[model samples]
Target chain A: MLRPPYEIVLKPYGKALVELARERTDIICLSGDLTRQTETDLFRDALPDRFINVGMAEANMIGIAGGLARAGHTVFVNTFGVFCTRRCYDQVAMAIAYPNLDVKIVGFMPGLSSPGGPSHQAIDDVALMRALPNMTVVDLADAVEISQAVRAVVERRGPVYLRLKRGEIPVVSEASRRFSLHEAQVAKKGREACIVASGMMVPAALVAADVLDANGVSTCVINSPVIKPLDAATIVAAARGARAVVTAENHSVIGGLGSAVAEALAEAGVGVPLRRIGVADVFAESGSREYLFDRYNLGVQNIVDAAWITIAPTKPVPAAPAMPLTAGTYAPV
Target chain B: MQKRARLNGKSPGGCGDGRLRAGAPAPVRVGDLARLATRIRLHAVHMVGIQGFGYLGQALSAAEIFAALYGGGLMRPGWDRFCLSPAHYAVVHYAAAAEVGLLHPEALKSYGRDGTELEAISTERTPLLDLTCGSLAQVISGAIGFALASRYAKDDRRVFALLSDGEMEEGQTWEAAMFAAHHALDRLAVVIDANNSQVDGQVNSVTTLEPLADKWRAFGWRALEVDGHDADALVASMQSTASERKPLVVIGRTQILGGLKSVPATADGHFLKLDPALKAAVIAELEARLA
Candidate 1:
C-alpha cells in the first residue's frame, strides 16, 4: 500500500502529541484557551488530569508552565502565534527563558497560515524566539516532522519555542535522518545555487529546486529543522561551490531564517551574493495561506526567480575576512 | 520606564522622634529582630546619604517586614528562596543580607554605583539573591514558579515573594495570585508591603488597590493582615502553617516613612536628595534605636 505523497490531514500532529503525552505522564499540556485551534485539545482530552486551560492569558500560561516544568513536568505550551511571542514576551523571556527551564512553547499557525489577519498570525515568531537566549526554536517543514519534533524537544533540556503547522502538508524530506534538532539536511545537491529554507518554505524550496533542475541549472535545497543553533558547517559546505545563495521561509525576511542564513554565510566568509525570498517587511492582509504566499512572492515561482538571479553568470568576488573557517578558531569576518 | 511609577505617599507632617519613643518603645516583642530592623533602616539611610536619593521612604516602611522575613527563621540565606519584586528595594535586601551575614559587611558601600552588583533594584548578580526583578509585578509569577518547582522536587523548602502595594496594579499579579491558589501551592507565601506610597503620589490616588485582602481571599488564598512594622506580629503570622491545598499571603500594613526618626518634615523621602542635617539625624536616630 502506497501512502499518499501529500497528507492533508491535520490529525497526525495532534495524534502524535497525544501519544507522547500518554507515554510520559510528566508531559503536561497548557493551553491559553486555544486548545481547539492549536490542536492541543487532543492532549487535553487524553490526559485531562495533566492539562490546564489558562483562559486567554498568555503570560500567566507561560508562568504556570514554567512552574509546572520546574516541578519536574515536561510542559508543552500552546497558543496562537502572536499571543505567544508578543503578548507573552516578558513572561517567556523572564520566567521561562531566563531561568532556562524545561518548558516547550508550541506556537501554532506559523507565518501566514491563518485567515484571521495580522492579529491572529505570527509572522515574526521565529525572529522573536531566536533573539532570546536559551530558546531552541524549530518551525516544522512537513506533517511527518511533527512527531519527530515532539520527541526531539522532549528529549532536550531547556526551554524551546516550536512553530507548529496543522492541515495537510507534503513530506518534502522523506528520507531525512529522523529529524536531528541542530542538523541541516541536503535534500538535493547540484550546486548551481544553494536554497536554504526551514519550516513551510521547505516544500517551496524543493519545488523551486525542481524548477531550476529542469532548466539545466542545478540547485541545492537544504532543510534546516532547527533555526537556532543552526548547522553552520553544513550550511557553508552546502554553499561551497554554489554560485550564490538564496534563502526561503514562511516568515518575514527581516530577522527570520533568511537573516540567520545570511549571518552564517557572512561569518563563514562565503561572500556569496544572496537573495532572501520570503515575506517582505510588511503587514499581510487576511487571506488563505496560498493567497498570501503568492501575494508575498514566497511561492515556488519566487524561489525560482531568486535562484536565477543568484546563480546568473557574474564576476568572482573576494572571500570574506580570510580566516580558516574551522571549529577550533571561529574568528570574526 | 516602569521605574518611579509607584504612586508615592505625601511627606508626613510629623518626623517625630520615632527613636523607640523612650517609654513608648518600638515593637521589641520579636526578640533581636528589632535591632536587625534598625540596622537595616540605618544602612538604607547611609545608602540614601551616599546617593543623596533612593526609595528611602519605601525602605523605611518595609524594614520590619524584611526583618521578619530575612531576620526570622521563615527565610534564610541558602535554604529558602526570597523574591523581591520592583528591584528598587535592593538596599533593604542587602541590609537584611548583611545582618544575616550572607553578604560581606563592607560590600554595602557600592549601593548604586556603576560596575557594582549592588543595583538600585535587586538582580541575580547580587550574591545570595535568587530572583532578579526590576520590571514590576512579574516576580510574583516567577516566585510562583519557584514554589511550584520546590514542591515538584519534593524539597521541604518554601518560596516567599516580597511585593509592594503599587505592584498590585500589574495584572500578572492577580493572574499569578489565582494560579497559586488554583495549584494549591502551600509552600508559597506572598507578602505585600501596603505602604500606601508610590512615585506619583498616594497609591490610592494612582489606582485603587483597596479591598486588597478580600481580593486575595477571592482568589482562593489564605489571606492575613498584620502590622508591617510590628516584627512580632509579622513574624508570628508568617510562621503560621497552611495546608498543602492552599497558598498563604500576608498584607503588612505600614507607614511609608514611619521607621525613621527625622526628616525635612516636608520631604516625602520617596526619592529625594536628603538634607545633610536630616541625613545625620536619620543615622543618629537609628543608632540610638540599635543602642
Candidate 2:
C-alpha cells in the first residue's frame, strides 16, 4: 500500500491562546513586536484590546506582563526563546518568579527549531528556567500537547515558562489526549530500555524506539512535558523496569532533560546505565533544522545508537561509544 | 461632590477643579504635607540608622516627592498605585507608605532584615507596592500595564511610578515611555527623581539626558519640570489635567542628597550607611526636626 507524503501541520499555539482569551476575559497577550513570529497574532486579532505590542522591548514586555499578572490577569508574554530566557533572565526570575506572579512566558522556536543561527536558538532555555525558583517549565511535544499544556498553565497559579515550536510541526500524538503538567505519558511500553524525551524530541524518540524495536531492542518511550517539576516517579519506574535508560531532548545536554534525568536516577538510587543524546556543549552554527539536528547528534540515528549502547545486557553499560566526540561536521552513523 | 465643588470655589489653587495638577488642591494644606515630608525623611534616616546601612541619600532627596504623592491627597495611598522602580530607594517608599498609614509603622524595624516582608528592594511583599522592582527602568512597564488594566476595567484610579534619573540610561525606560504614550494612558503618571546621582557618579556626567523634557514630549507625553521639594506645586501638577490626552512625566529636579543635617552628603547617595557618630547626629537631627 502506498502511503501519503509526510506533511508539516501548523500547530495552534496562537489559536489556543485566542480561545483561552475568549473563555477568560482576563487572558491578555503581550508581544515584543514578534506577533507573527510567536504566532500571538491570532490572539491579538481576536482580542485587540487585550493584546499589547511592546515593540522591541523584551524586558519591558516582561515587566508589563508582571503588572498585568499582579492585577489578576493571565498574561502571556511572547518572543523568541532566546530573548525570553537569556536576553532578560533577571526580569523573568525576579519580576515573574521571585514574587510568583501568574505570568506565562511563551517563547517560540526552542532549540534548533529556528534557522536564525545560534543567536536565535534557545537550547539553554529549559536549563535557565529550571534553575529559577517558583517557575513551572513545560516544553510541548506537538500541537495536541499544546492544547493541554496551555490550559494547565492557565489554570495553575504562579509563573510558567512554556517552550513553543512555531510553524508547521508534525503531529505525533492524538489530539483527544489530555496533557498533565506533572504526569509523564508513556508513548510506548517496552522493557529493554527506557527512552525519556521532551518537547519536539518526543517524536524523534518514538521513531528511534521503532528502529530499536526492529533491531530486537524493546524500548519504552516516556514523554515528559513538565521538565522542572519532573515526573520523577514515572521516570524512576520506567528506568527501573529497564536495565538501561536513555534521555533525548532538543536542548543542550547540560542543565536540561539529560541533566534532570541524571539527577533523578541518582537521587532515586536507580543504578541503570544511562545515555544522553542531545546537543554537545558547543555553539551551534546556522543551518536547517535537519542539518542542525544531525550536526549536533540529535538525529534519530543518534538516539537509536544511544539506546542500543545503553541496552547492553551488562551492569553499567560502557559509556565510551555513547560519548562520540564531534570529530567533524555531520559524522555519519 | 457638592462639598468638593464648594471647597474648590473658595481655594485660590491651581487645582481648583479638584484634579491633581499644578493647580492647588481644593483643600490646600501645604504645611501639613511639608511636615509629612519631613517625617518621611526622618523615618528613612531612622531606618538607615537601625543597621547603619541603607540608601539614605536618595531616600532623603525623594522624601518630599513621596510626601506630595501620598500625604497631599493626589495619591490616595491605598487607592492609588505607586510603583517604586528604583529598588535601592525602598527606604523612601517604605517610609512614605507607612506615613500615609498604608503600612504599619513597625514595619520599619524589619527594613533590610531577613525574613521580613520589607525587602531591601521594593518587592511586592511590602504593602501598597504593586510591582516587585527587579532591575532598573523596568517598573515603568508595570505602571503602564496597571494603567491599561484600569482603563480596561473603566476605572479612573491613576497609576503612579517613581524612577531615578540614572535609570534613564536603560533602553527599557524609553520603550515603556513610548508604549504608555502610544496607548494614551493618561491615567498613568511617572515621576523621574532627577537627582543627578548614580553608582558611577552624576547621571548627566555619565550619560547626558539633555533636554529630557523634549525627549518625553517627542515620545508623545505631556512632560513638565518642577522642584521635587515643592510639595504644593508638585501636588497641583499631579491633580491638574494639564497633561491630559496622554501619559504624564514630571521631571522632578532634586538633589542627590538633600535635607540631611548630620549625614554628610556623598557624591552619590545611591546607598549609604553613615558612620556611628554621623548616624547618631542624623537621628538627633531627625528627632529635633520631628519635634
- Whose DockQ is greatest here? 2
What DockQ do the predictions score, one after another? 0.18, 0.28
Q: Estimate the TM-score of every prediction.
A: 0.84, 0.88
Candidate 2 residue-wise lDDT at A102: 77
Those runs of model 2 whose alpha carbons end farther than 4 Å from true positions after fitting are A1-7, A313-333, B1-31, B265-268, B283-291
Q: Could you tell me the TM-score of chain A in candidate 1? A: 0.90
What is the CAPRI rating of model 2's predicted complex?
acceptable
Scored by CA lDDT, what does every candidate get? 0.75, 0.77
Tens digits of per-residue lDDT for model 1, A1-333: 011234344555678889988898677788888888878778787888777787777777887676555445678888877898978898888767866777889887888877888897788999999999989989884766776788888888888988877555455445454788878888788777888988877766776777678777788888887889889889989887788789988889988888998999999889888899877988888997767876878777777777776665462321112222243221111
**For residue A104, what is the lDDT in candidate 1?**
89
lDDT at B31 for candidate 1? 54
Residue pairs in clash, model 1 = A8-A168, B6-B198, B6-B199, B7-B198, B8-B198, B8-B199, B8-B201, B87-B121
lDDT (tens digit, per residue) of candidate 2 on A1-333: 000112345547887888878998878888888998888878777889888888888888887887776665778999989999999998787667876777899988989878998899998999999999989899984767787678889888788999988776545566567789879888888888889999877766776777677677788899998998999999999999687798988899999999999999999999998888777877798987767887888867778777776555453322212223232221112
By TM-score, the best candidate is: 2
